[model samples]
Target: MRFNDVIMALLVIVIILMIIIPVPLGWLDFFLALNISLALTILVLSMFVKETLEFSVFPSILLITTLFRLALNISTTRYILSDGKAGEVIDAFGNFVVGGNAIVGFIIFLIIVLIQFLVITKGSERVSEVAARFTLDAMPGKQMAIDADLNSGLITENDAKERRKKIQREADFYGAMDGASKFVKGDAIAGIIITVINILAGFMLGAFTMGYTLSQSIQKFTLLTVGDGLVSQIPALMISVATGIIVTRAASESNLGTDVLSQLFAQSKVLYIVGGVLMLIGIATPLPNLPFITIGIAIMLSALRLTQDKKELEEQAEFESEQEEERDNNDIRKPENIIPLLQVDPIELEFGYGIIPLADPNQGGDLFDRLVMIRRQIALEMGIVVPMIRLRDNIQLDSSEYLIKIKGNDIARGTIVFDHYLAMSPGVVEGEIEGIDTIEPAFGLPAKWIRSEDREKAELLGYTVVDPSSVISTHLTEVIKKHSHELINREDVKQLIENIKESNSALVEELMPNLMSLGDIQKVLSNLLKEFVSVRDLVTILETLADYARSTRDVNILTEYVRQRLSRQLSRTYFPFGKAKVVTLEQSLENMLMEAIEQNENGTFLSIDPMTSQNIVASLAQEVRKLIQMGEQAIVVTAPIVRFYFKRMTEQSIPELVVLSYNEIESDIDIQSAGMVSI
Candidate 1:
């Protein structure tokens, strides 16, 4: 129905018709040019494509172009035999390309055909077959590796599915290429046969049918035959070369041309040796002086240039390092330079030099990408925007050690074994695989630094295996979550409001500057975050604040109302099993906390004697331990009134324990009291 739908079909039909019907000289010349240009483009693409899958459709294109070349060959053959003229393209190749010398041109044509058929086509066929066989044979091992990564949580289920699909596509590509090589081989042989037939048939037809002499027949037919062979076989040679390149390409980040150039001239010392050897031969042996000496001089200059470039890069790195140290020293002389010291990165990951390659993208490290995903992960899970993390190398640290800093102070630190996998048992171990014992940084679980080769075995044995980068990333994510509340500021809060204002402008317009100031709202959100609660549901948080600010201006009181409003979300977050296992406070203790609660213009506080507060905390800790012993998180549920007071009293003693008001639990959730607390 549309032009694009049947454009390829129409081209195929035209090619077939060209083989049967006589082509005019003008159209034939155009087809000849098209053939050469298409072959050249294919050759260039083969060299530039970085991956085999990137050129997956190459086999199909090869077959179609091969058929098109054959159609042109047939059309040219008909014209050369019947009319004694093919086209201007063929005539020019006959006269200009080989100086009108039919013998030399014919020999060149034979060489090109033999080279394509015997060398490029045959080698490409063998390579394609080998690649296909190897891909199929290695399929099971690759599949197992994918499964191991997925089982170990190194990759997601979607990633495993994509890798499996890629493996299948690669196998199919190699198999198709293996068969396509035969077409090129066949095309080469056909070119030789057609050239011989053209020359023989043309010579006889000119001599007998036209009453021409030997010289006239020889001159007319020989030149045409040589030119036709040259034009057809040159393109065939290029296509065959392209096929060879495609089949032999290995996995690389760069194209074939860049890879070749980078690797070929990587070492200046090797070039120096080569240049010296060339000069020695020119001076000491019986060889021509001019060409050899000139080439040697050029090579030595190139080596010198390479050496200079390398030195400049080294100097640049050293100068930057020196400048950093010098700046620190210079800052001590000027007390006015305190501004630089006052500014701190929101988050910084400082690692040792041994881990540089893992952070350097030039060396194929994906640490940057992993950091980006970490931000996205937190955003999706906590509904908060994380600040950009800065990564730097600290030479003073141990080679394997790294530190996580928040606002210029170290919060957590860990070490990683580069080029090794960290494998930890998930409460199950079938067999013991030898490795260096250590602890996983994220959860402080007992783990091992195992060789990469043993990762599959570790995963199969019910161990969770993760690479060095994944280990660090997981650790960073946990630290961010633990201190997520501290990372947000007034600016971040304002941005959150601006985001909500896009769709529900009235809610934002009614909430901000009307009931609560920006500082009050920020403090409320921070308090919620300090309790490991998500401030992502900004609309509900804002609505609750708007409803309750008339009654109280205290952020702590406002936060409690917001938490009560987010009961459903909280219920799902902590009690996914539709039941809550928590430690409940005694009514007598709750009454004591309600009586001890004190308020000021600043905020609310729990005003109690130190000895009584310690006794209450000790009782609460005793009850929390009961829940923790049963593999449940430490949760304290109190009456809505004393919830804030109880949490304020016992926070220092049980920072990890969650304090929830009875009103914070959803109505549908069943409350399973794990233990009771009293003082």
Candidate 2:
């Protein structure tokens, strides 16, 4: 049998023997039977109504009620038998232990209950410890934001540091709150209730008079009536119950419900005056039982209601939070037309201090001191400072040859090309990447064919770490070059480049394998701008790449609309070309177009309709004047007789100027896109 079943069976057997053996053996048998019957009824009732035995204030109701009646019967019977002319009683063991044995058994029961109390209280402590750890871990990101803003000249640095310190203080505060929570947890409150009830019953029995006296009892029984002592105990009783209720309500997270419960159930100084009045009633009146029962029951019921209220409130709040999350998910917008950008790759860091004997994963203080010099060197290079060190767990070191085999077979053999640079971009910070040429021979290790562990070793050797993004552009460039053959036109390639230049990598991560679609690209950008705080350099890169990509494809009409809507952005500002150049490229192209338009008509021009010729000439002249003023590098016009192009003269020793179209006016067909512009 399980331990609980064994204990329970022993208790049942004890009660049964006490009731049965005394029945045929003595005059006090009825009283002994009453106590046994009460215990047996409780045990049996607990099987069906398991909650009555639960370690909560409600469970104390059943225990205290049953024990109170047991005390009353035992006291009454013992006094009658001992004071009267009855022979001594014999127990089931045939020992003449007298009428006092029943009281002895009750004392043993109290001891067993205390042991159970400790077990439940310890369990509460453990649960609260886990809760405190979770709250501490989740607060870091918020702390970092405040710190960054303060450091970037937007806010005072001291304020940011103070904010971080406040978060730590809050974590500690919650841990203390957990301790307070233990006082009101089920087991502690239940134990307190049982103790208070026993005190009340003891006071009444000792002070009240029912004309009862023990017959040949081991100790004399008092006929004391309920008196001033009941009054004195009332204050202490109120204090204990009020403490339990208030602490329980405060520790719970249900905001409004907890507040209401706390206000209603928690006692005020006014309640203490009322309690004092009840004490005086006990001092003057013989019938003190009603007041005790009323007060005790009131406190117990209040505790139960507060517990239930907290639970219900939490359930409602949890449901609301879940619904809010669902709505957020549904409202997520997918962009109809956008672009894709660069790809990101994860980089690993290798620590040089191979399996050190004294490393403590949870407490990195000693390790930080040991590695502080190197860390500071890297930090100086990177231009960053970290007040605390965070050490990762589960680092492994292997034999040199094993490292060589893994690096050679698994890493270098893979599809990634790495370049190594010592101390690359300065000191290492979290999320930084350093390039490595080959995975082999860093620490008796080589870049080629390195295993994962060996690659980690190389990181420890000379490599610095960088953000996953710092290398994304390089990776995308490689991908484009490899897949350029698949592109249908130069515009496609240009669009791809633009998208890469403008996209935010962290947002692109959401699109995953479907990043090729415009909708996915737009969704990523929207999600990124909405979700992330303090946009990093990576976010800037993604946005740039996206804009560039859209320009190349010209698929999203929104870009064109934006281009036209923002006149300043589209206005060409470059004027007379340069020092090494005779004229500005824009002026040269404009001059060329102008010369071509006039020259194409020949030195003398005529038209069958003189008015049509004048209109054509005038329109051409206005277009030329605007082209020069606007500073455009190129412009095309469709006309009746011929097409003209002003080609900028570059090869001839002639000044950088425009040339007329001696070439034919080709078929008037629409060319959809500008190929590529190299800057």
Candidate 3:
């Protein structure tokens, strides 16, 4: 066994022996001294530790010490009642500490008991109860905060896990403390009972059984009983005080003593005022002036010295800060410093200073939390992991302006009034509102920045009103959706495959590492996402890819086959409750495109004439605009052989339009031909 473990086992045996066996006077004195030393050690340690967690073993220590003290009380009581002399430690305390007066000793012991039971122990118990309750109540909020930090990339997974463990430990510690305080309270009560029994039993045994005179018996036994009570109660009082300190100590980087000193004596001016008040009282009051004047002068000198020390420390810190800044500037001039500057966030939001309150929770803003939800929402809607966006403040922009950037390039910018509501007309407003005229950054709709009080009026007038955070979040969501294809890389594809492998290992193993490379799958998935197709159904997409991947090495063909397999998903998404409204190419134009197509092992490319390509694009653009104006999504249906080339042709002109092959539509869904594109 380890040394500490063996010692603890021996200590437990000793405590039991003290309770069951008769203890010699020397041993009783030794145990009493040991108890006092242990309690004193605990008190000093509690004062020095920076935080409660640093002394997490305190609850167990409290129970063990309480038991040890009880055992000692039993042994001392046996010694006093049997022989009328407990120990030399008790004798010294009885005569020297309390002037051999039983009444004075008992009063002092009672004072210690009352102070511990009523003040320190009671207060510590209440604080522990409240701390435990608050910790449990705030657990959900704390966990959510940790998740927000983890999701926002402020902390790593390991850091978040460690923080969660710390929170749990704090809760458990406070709960243990809530129970441990009861041990101290019970110890105080037991001490009182033991002291009373020792006095009554010791006197009877000394006078009647030992045949001593009444006055002699009372003197000897009363002194010993009071002395034993005082020794036990003093140590108990120290422990109770320590318990109060531990429970009441807030978490800080400094120890309790240092924290108290720094905060209580931080201001020299307060000390000066106190010293001045003392001096005035000494001169005015009809009492001894010398003592008060001397102490007041000492306080004034100490305050002056503190002021000087504070100034010197500030000057030293200033010098160190300047030196550090110079060293940093020198380091920044190095090539290594420039290397970090080259690395940019994949997605970022830069806002002006005025918008900081919209992001900072301390200022009643929840933009960071909102952004976390935004990322999750986009992942669910677009079926891709949106990268963590870095939020920062820039002073070069207008105070109310914010911009979204993808890959170090600004893609969208918006401006909002800090404390005003953005009232937008959904289609038309019932009445015009008086406010600052502005364009809504998310949708470019006409909006007015109105007072918060006007929000009800705006809503009553059939206008949609939103706060600044919602405006920024909505803009960021749209920007992410538009650039999701660019965000997916080989790592994301690898992650998806690995996640799938956990449940369908055989299928993933058979398809990956043998049939297609990771890059090839990433390309196909990126191609699907380029048209805003949800790749959430990975089992189906991978299965379709595995079937056709061996025959063709082209990623585009694989993506097209996957799309054909996912036609049902597409049909439901686009045509939720009605027929699929689509525009189709004329037979002549389709044949012309087929004839112009050139195929190779690499891929298919349209080798059409310039005039023919222009005419086709012009005709398609006209029909696409018509469909959009009628509030219908523009989808072009073409033959399976020409779908790829047709999409490629009209991609630049109508990027928002979706082109599907004739075979890609499900047979169950009704189709409506809105128009036809011809050249």
Candidate 4:
């Protein structure tokens, strides 16, 4: 039900109770009935208006009763003076207030007391439940997204893991602290009982003192004292009613419940009822001394309880507010704690050795070996979480002259591309190129000079001759994977092509099919046959040359096996450097990068230096030497270094394209340079 409706319903019930109650019954006075009616009506209005039960309504009730008591005192004085039993009448008035007022006020106050108590109890409960819901629901959903990214290689798994743990720890700490702050239950009721005792004490004392003092001073004065005390009870009575409404409302708002103790201590109605009883005792009882002291004591007790309850309410409000703020924080991880976990860039590599064709025997490597070395070097240095596409290529391989999507120092990248051509193939001539050579000297080979096989192999490996910027979505994990897979397959196909090129197919073709329409298949078969014959002939020749009589079966077989393996090895060797071995490079790179960062007194972080291809290659070679020395596998760093900084390094301070790791570099580390494979 609406709050307004609920309050109206409560007021209606109180009004009905008031109407049915016998007026002036037993010791009840008509004036007392009128006072009860006024208190109840005002309380109902207060509730309906939504005034807070403790602070707002209690203060109002106190002021109202003070006014009512002043009026009552004047009326009693007038009545006593006119009656001619002025002294006797005045004394009787004190007796009437302490005894009769107490009885009548108690009866009437009960009805107002019940209604205020009920409304406040229910309201505070609903507020607390709503608060709990607002704090705990959305955290896990956000964490799931981070988990998926880490698993898919879209983000570093280590970074995601740390972020998740940090969130969990924070949540645990918040929960524990919130639980510790709730108020102790049942404390409110003890407060109310104390309030009642205090009121009784204050009223009795005031009544006794007034009667004794006035009686000693003068007979007429005694009458006047009794009359004034009776009137004074009215304000106390009214203040009691106000206190009752406030405590009741506050308790109800606190949601501590209708437990007798909590209700008594927490309910404002208890104070109001106590106040009313004190007033009645002061006015109706013949014991003038006891009522005043009792009521004063009761007023003090009620005030103390109200103060305490207000503090608890304030505390609870603070807790709920904090819970709500935490709910808001669930949407994003704290940048300071978790932002460092995401990859800054997709791919980064340093290419060393000036841009040149791979087939140059003078440069000391086959085109394919140089390409393989380049890929491995990149994988090691950048933490290869994403694929590095070759932005520059030797044109004799019919590959794009530049690799697209390479992220590294521009000078290093260019020099590496130049070195690739100069060193990879035999008979490739190198010349100083204006644009290619910046701080570092660089050389490039003409396209025609590169072997056709080398060109085919380079193209197969996804080494585009275009600039690195041309590749779309370079940082995306899926795109890099797709490109890497294509390159691998291309390399495989090129190897098969090279096998066909060097074989003596004509000699083997004598045993192959003579179909005109299936020439491609025939050629493939002829190539296969030549490979088999060469293996067979070499094995047969080795067996015949061995001294069979002296040689044991094992020795004879080992010699034949060695000859066949040598023939196959000689045929397959591409890059003069060596076969490119793939390793798990990420751990090593991370360690190297962290070490480098720490080692720098200026706090400069490293990235793959993008310029000076030879420097890029040399830097990679240094990192590879370290990794090889440590004997660790190389893995890729999926995010590129978008920004890095060192404290006190340079005026710019930030490091971008810092060289990370070098690993598995064959003894001939200079053979391959890592290129900046840009994100």
Candidate 5:
């Protein structure tokens, strides 16, 4: 179809024909020249390629060229056996290249064959096999690294995909090379066989059929055979060398020639030492000192020039770096640069200088990797996607301190001693160990900072030993759990709805904008999240809201209905063993709150007197303390009508108290009244 494609097809046809048909001496010379030219071009191209992938088509090209050379060898053998002459190309190589001696020419051809077969071909084959094995072995590790970078927000999804594709391509390239090296090895063996056959057969045909004497036949056929062998073996040698170069080359940004020159001559000091050594040898020996002295002086001058060039390059790089820094400073001074500072990361971690190694991968720290796992864990447990956390260094803080922030406000801060283990008492210790006393930043549990060597001793004493990074990560996890509701907004709600719409489109269309708006649903979900309820079961929550939304527009009432529908989930979270220890209000206090519910346009409020409100709060606080003392959760169970008011009235004073209505408890769970509050 295209010009290059047509030429390639025709060239392949010609190579096939060369093996089946006879060629004149003139054409044989031309084909011999073409073969040599092709081999030389391939050798040069291999030296200039930046990486193996840049010349991915080389394996096919190698097979084609090897076949073409073998075909030419066959055609030249035909002419030599029948006529005792191949072509000028072969004759010139036989006479001029080897001084017109058949013995010398044959010896030289044997040397070329030995070099290509034993050295280049064998070595390249082994290297290709090793490279293929290593590439495949390292594939899993490279894939995991890419996934870690993607999860940590260091690279985008597209970047991770591209990296994975590149790794696969490298593996394929090395595998192809492993198989391609065999072609050159086989070609070398075939060349040896063809040369031996041509010499033996040529002698027989010339002495018997052509009627020449045995000596004359030997002389004439020997020269023709040696010349043909040399013509083919020289090009084969070049190709074998090229194959070795391709397989041995490492992936670099520069071509092979540039890389070799730069690395080999990088240090001028080595050259100067060598030149001095040569001059001393010349002076010590009784040889001609002038020759060695002249060469040494030239080497010394080249070294000096290289040193000057390296210095100029370094100076140029430094000057460019300074100019770039100045440009950045000028850009920072502009008012437009201040706009970015106004926007805050949804979640952020700021560390002091001493703790910087905890986030640096080069220092054997896995903080970033741990953070990626934390996000995945939160999604599974809380049914919410946590945004990428921005980690940075804050020089204003103490060297051992770090802080976690939400919406630009610090929610949790902790101090850790680097190069030490935090040994926390696991409720019981067999004996006391020598260490610095401190508090576990996540739970305020008493802990001791122990030396690295003391970790085993502390663990043997029944204490939980944790590293500094783990301690900080645990604290950050707890803070995120506490502030999850604040992190979610209307956009998150819309995303959840859209995800559900994929499987339940009709349900979403019927419920949204008809019975309630998106904001209304956001409020209901937010209310559920405030008490650590996972809204991952959006189908159930939305169905319940759609059923009750038409009767009342109150978000609190709708959330209560959703909770009742999700009683099994809530019961499992609070009472994993199917039993709940709760604190109930007395009948008189419940009745009093029920009567105080005054409804108006702004919604219902508790219209109780000051003494009544104070007594209610005081009695609940006393009961909460008793539950805490007994190591039981403080849950307040009341009538559904008064549950909202009761929680709203005492939420500020007793935030840890969980207020649940009778309808919100699952029927199968066993309920135990641990305490009762009376006003």
Candidate 6:
């Protein structure tokens, strides 16, 4: 063990040994002085520390000090009754400090005990109890605040962890302080009982056995008993006061003295009022004039000085403010100052004045909160973080029109009527309800705007009903999903790699920079998202890339391999039912497309004739329209190699069409060929 640890262990043992061992009067005096000094140090240290957690070990200190004081009391009591003397420290306090009057010394000791037990210790216990309870009660809120700050990028992960630790320490410190105050209370009661025992025992031994007169015995024993009590009670009183100070102190950036002075003298007006009150009393009352009048004049002079200082401080502040404004004006004129303006948000939803209430939280508009939830929802569904969205009002648009933009380019626009609900038929409606004719902004389905009164009736008539805010929110969600591929950047892909690296480091290290770059990884993820595939299963995606990246660094081919590797997810997502209806390509057509695949420096491309491609597109559309008329999604299943090229060729004409490979579909789903594409 270290030397300091040895000393601490020996100190506690010695304190316990003191209660059982006899010591010389000189040693007793030294120990008594040490006790006083320790108590004083503790008191001062408590005042100097700005926060309570800085003295988290105070409860243990309180227990140790109380034990030391009790042991000292026992030693002095033994010496006083057995030898008629304890030590010079106690004797001096009895005679010099209390004027050798037993009655006066005893009264002083009792007063000290009463003050500590009744006022300081009692109040400290109550405050500690309440503080501990409140600290624990507020723990959840503090933790949530830290998490929110981390999510909002206001603080880093390390900062959040540190704050959470501090909160837990606060709860623990207050809990210990609550229990430690009991030691002070019990010590007060013990002090009283020990004093009584010493006096009574010393009197009996002196008068009966020590061969002293009754008056002498009473006087000698009384003085010695009062002195011992005084020495112990003084230290106990200081400790109790320290306990109260620590429990009541608020968190601050400065020591107690500085805080007290700054807060007490914060306002010159309050000081001036007090000075006037004192001056009036000194002049009007018949009480002592010189003392009160002298103090009153001093206070008034201090107040005058304080007021003059305030004026000078205000003038300095105003001058500094003007200088700062001048510097700001110059800074604005600098060309580099406009650099921050060049950066644009990844996504922005700019609405008109009529849509303000739908977006303003203060006006019961939940659009801001809806946006937050939308980010989380997309993260869960797409396995990619939706960047921070910017919401604002644009006056250039129609009053009800709102626009959604990606990378500063407008993508979609919609209109809303506040306080009105959009009603659409589910094709099972019993009857038609009278309403304003409209189209659903999200899916472009036929819809109607109905009054608040008609919302319930429209729903009863089997029509789907939604509010204006929901309409805008749904439209925005669809637009983001369609354009999420545009938002994936090198940084975002790096974050995903880092996230997956935490668990699958070997896979990430194998693929990144060695075989593929950040840009390559981002491109592969974008291609997956462009097809509405969830990258949430990033581990599987990365592992597959690591296996195939060595053969070819082409992102398009890598994405194709990743899609096949995520066959289960594809099956579960696209074919939730046990059956599927899909359009299939003819074997001859598949072979022709696979043979037409060509490689270049840019990547792979389909080299088929334009006329044949157009004829194939027309033929595929004609076949896929049969499923569309049957209320089925347009799906085309082909060989894995031909799926990519065919999807690219037909994407322009049918952007919503889902082109799948036979390898992408799970075996459990029985596929019925609804039609076939031929050229």
Model 2, stretches more than 4 Å misplaced?
1-116, 141-180, 185-207, 214-679
Clashes per candidate, residues 3 or more apart or on different chains: 0, 67, 0, 160, 0, 0
- Cα error, residue 653 of model 5, in Å, equals 16
Lowest summed lDDT window (length 10), candidate 1: 147-156
lDDT of 1 at 250: 87
**Highest TM-score scorer:** 1
lDDT by residue for model 4 (443-516), tens: 23232222323433333332222212111112222233323322223334334334533664542233223311
Model 5 quality (TM-score): 0.58
Instruction: Give the per-residue lDDT digits (tens) of candidate 5, residues 1-679.
Output: 6999999999899899989999787888988999999999999999998888777888888889999999999998888887778889988887789888888888888999999999999999999999999888767656755654454344567788999998999899889989998999999899899988988887889899999898888878878888888888888888888888888888588988899998887789988987887788779988789988888888788899999999999999999999999999999999999998899998999999999999999997889987887787677667888888999999998999999999999888989987898888868879999899999987788999999888767766767777787788778877887788888888988999999999999889989999999999989888888888898899999899889999999888898899899999888888888986789989988998898889888766889888878888999999888887888888889988888889988988898789988888889989888889899
Better of 5 and 6 by lDDT: 6
Error at 579, model 3, angstroms: 27
Regions more than 4 Å wrong, model 5:
1-17, 23-27, 146-168, 213-215, 278-295, 313-404, 407-679
2 or 3, greater by TM-score = 3
Candidate 1 vs candidate 2, TM-score winner: 1
Q: What's the TM-score of each model vs. the native? A: 0.74, 0.24, 0.61, 0.19, 0.58, 0.61
Model 6 quality (TM-score): 0.61
Which stretches of model 3 miss by more than 4 angstroms? 1-10, 150-161, 305-348, 355-401, 407-409, 412-679
Clashing pairs in 3: none
